[model samples]
Target: MKPILTATVVAALVAIALPAVAQNASQIARVRGGASCAGCNLFQASLSGLEARGLNLSGARLRQADLSLTVMNRTRFSNADLRDVEAYGGVFSSSNFSGANLTNASFVGAYLQGARFSGATLTGVNFSGASLQRATGLTQSRLNQACGDEATQLPVGLSIPRC
Candidate 1:
């Protein structure tokens, strides 16, 4: 190929890659200094080790995000879309996930003590070996699939399963 043609192809590829790079820069910027990204669509974004504790991320679309090993304690994720998210080993203690869609999210061995999942859809979520102490509005089905203790709270007339 001629030098000009090679340069043109490289320039085209760089043009295509520039927008993605800029978008990633913005994502990093927004996560700093207790940023709150409400109503933003962050589906399938990897937010590992971002120190996003206590941020108000309500109504954000975090579907299939890799938030593993992140310190997101006390973050508000009410009504957020978190379907198929990989949050294994993440510390989500005291976080509010009320009405969030968490279908098929993997929370294996996660530290979710006192997290609220009231009215949240937890269908097929893996909470195996997770510590859900003092979690409010926890359904029996959710607890049955995960590891919890007697201190875990449940809805009215819901019996603890043989988990």
Candidate 2:
């Protein structure tokens, strides 16, 4: 009886963990297959070096994900949670990130030409050497909440605090 009870508990724990694992796998599959996975649970996903253009991942959770060197041009990441993501050298030209939470994300040397950031939270985001010269919807107030290095390029009359 004790062995049976132990087995039941183990099975229950496995059942609880499987859903999260399966959900992550399914979300990764959908994104890799060029499907728009809105509001998907992609926490801590490793999607480095992928060149998926024009993806719609609005309201998705991409916290702690590895998006290094990815070319996600024109992707829609509006309202997405991108906290602590490592996106060094990623090309996100013309992507929409309005209302997204990008707290503490690293975008070092990223190309963000014409990206939109209306109402997005950029607290503690590392934009070292990132290009935002053509980005839109950024104001002094929004830039005040974020930090960047001297090499970080921004639109004229807009400056970012040094990280």
Candidate 3:
């Protein structure tokens, strides 16, 4: 009985020490089922290779999520929290990111043609090899807050610092 009590206490301590999963499983299921899950909590979600087009994820919390190779063309991510997301090789053409927080996010080799970035926070974002040639609502000030490699393609007369 004493040993069992000690084990229970140890398990409780371990659970407290670990970070809690803030994602909503039901919302994730909805997304998986090809449903739009606006304002959902998707923290640290692994959504690689997902091919959902026109997804409406506005106001969602997608911090530290993995979107590698995901084809979410024309998706809506307005006002979303996307900090530290990894979106390598993803196709997000014409997507909406207005008012989104993209701090420290990586978009290496991603396609973002004609996307909207109005009022989006681009601090420390890595756009290495990403294509944003026809993106809208981008200013020099916004680009200055982010970084890209020489292979990154932007609209004519606009450039970002090498990452």
Candidate 4:
């Protein structure tokens, strides 16, 4: 009985520590590689200047990540947690951001042409100097909470609100 209890405690501790270990491994991989942490916990990771095109990051936790100047064209970010992410000057053209949490994300000068943001949260997102031409799933209510400028391009029939 005592051995069984110790084994159970060890199992529980391993389970609890696994996620942290995985997160650390993912961070190391991102540094060694080009920020390619698919389905990994990258919470609050600073991936500035990352140049990983066509990388798959689906279901990854990237909340509060700094992705400034990253080149992630055609990358997949579906269902990723991107709340408070700073993607200024990042080129994410044709990227998939479906069902991602993008609350308070900054996309200033980011190129998002033909990107898919279906069902993603857009509260307080900054689109200043960003291009959203041909982007999908954007609503007026969501845009109302976003900040954009004249240089920001929207989808057809979508008008930009005053910043």
Candidate 5:
């Protein structure tokens, strides 16, 4: 009876730990797979300092993820859930962010030149010190929903609302 109880307790602990282990393994697999995390569930993951040019991250769940200082030029982030993400100092030049949920995301000191923001939800997004020069599909309504400082460089003919 004692051995059976111990075995059951061990099994219960293993079961409880398996999900976390699996999550970590999944993150590791995505990182190992050349930074292409399309349709991956990377919620609240710390992906800072990743240098992955042209990374395909479409439809990925990056809610509250830390993408600080990552260099992801021309990455595809269409339809990704990026709510409350912290992307400070990241370089995402020419990336496709169409239809992404960028609510409350911060891109402070990031370089986002020519990145597309079409159909993205930009409520409360912060672009402080970020560059969006020549970016496409940005509307005044969306810009109004976002916040930026004077250091935020916008596309020609487009202006940022007072932050």
Candidate 6:
């Protein structure tokens, strides 16, 4: 009976500690040069289903990160390194993405209306089912390069490019 009670206690403690241990996001934003991002390194972090509206993440490194279903309205990602990140179903309206590296990033089912992408490298990015109406620095040629799906919403008459 004593051994069983101890085992149960140990198991409970381990179960409680497991979630905290698993939620450690890699902090790697220790670079110089940026107004909003002075210090932060968030590589491959799991930010899925988080409500981070109006957050300042400028110049943050989030490569290969997961930001699915995250509400990022008015969020600032200017000059941030977001290569190969998964950000499907996020809200990025009125967000700033100037000079950001969004290579191979996917924004499926996201609301990116009024989002800015000026001077950003969007090579191999996917915007399938995402709304890009009124998004800055987003052109038809850019869309062609990124290759979105048929459900992607553009300004007008802008269909997804063929892969």
| Clashing residue pairs, backbone N/CA/C < 3 A, model 5 | none
lDDT of 5 by residue, 13-63 (tens): 889877552134476467545668788888887888888898888998888
TM-score of each model, in listed order = 0.71, 0.85, 0.87, 0.80, 0.82, 0.74
lDDT of 6 by residue, 9-112 (tens): 89998888774432223342222111233235667777787775676788777778888998778888999888999999988899998999999999888899
Best by TM-score: 3
Give the number of the best model, judged by lDDT: 3
Residue 23 in model 4: shift from native, Å?
A: 4.8
Q: Clash pairs of candidate 3?
A: none
User: Local distance difference test, per candidate?
Assistant: 0.75, 0.91, 0.93, 0.85, 0.86, 0.77
Candidate 2: lDDT over CA atoms? 0.91
Model 4 score (lDDT): 0.85
Clashes of each: 0, 0, 0, 0, 0, 4
Off by over 4 Å in 1: 1-28, 141-163
What is the alpha-carbon lDDT for the whole of candidate 6? 0.77
lDDT of 4 by residue, 1-163 (tens): 3455588889998888775532555463674386566777887777899888998888888888889999999999999888899999999999999998898899999999989988888888889999998898888877887889999999888876656
RMSD of each: 6.5, 3.6, 4.0, 4.8, 5.0, 9.8
Model 1 RMSD in angstroms: 6.5
Name every residue pair that clashes in candidate 2. Answer: none
Clashes in model 4: which pairs?
Answer: none
Q: Rank candidates, lDDT, best first.
A: 3, 2, 5, 4, 6, 1
| Poorest 10 consecutive residues by lDDT, candidate 4 | 19-28
Worst 10 residues of 6 by lDDT: 29-38
lDDT of each residue in 46-125, candidate 2, tens digit only: 88998999999999999899999999999999999999999999999999999999999999999999999999998888
Which model is ahead, 4 or 5, in terms of TM-score? 5
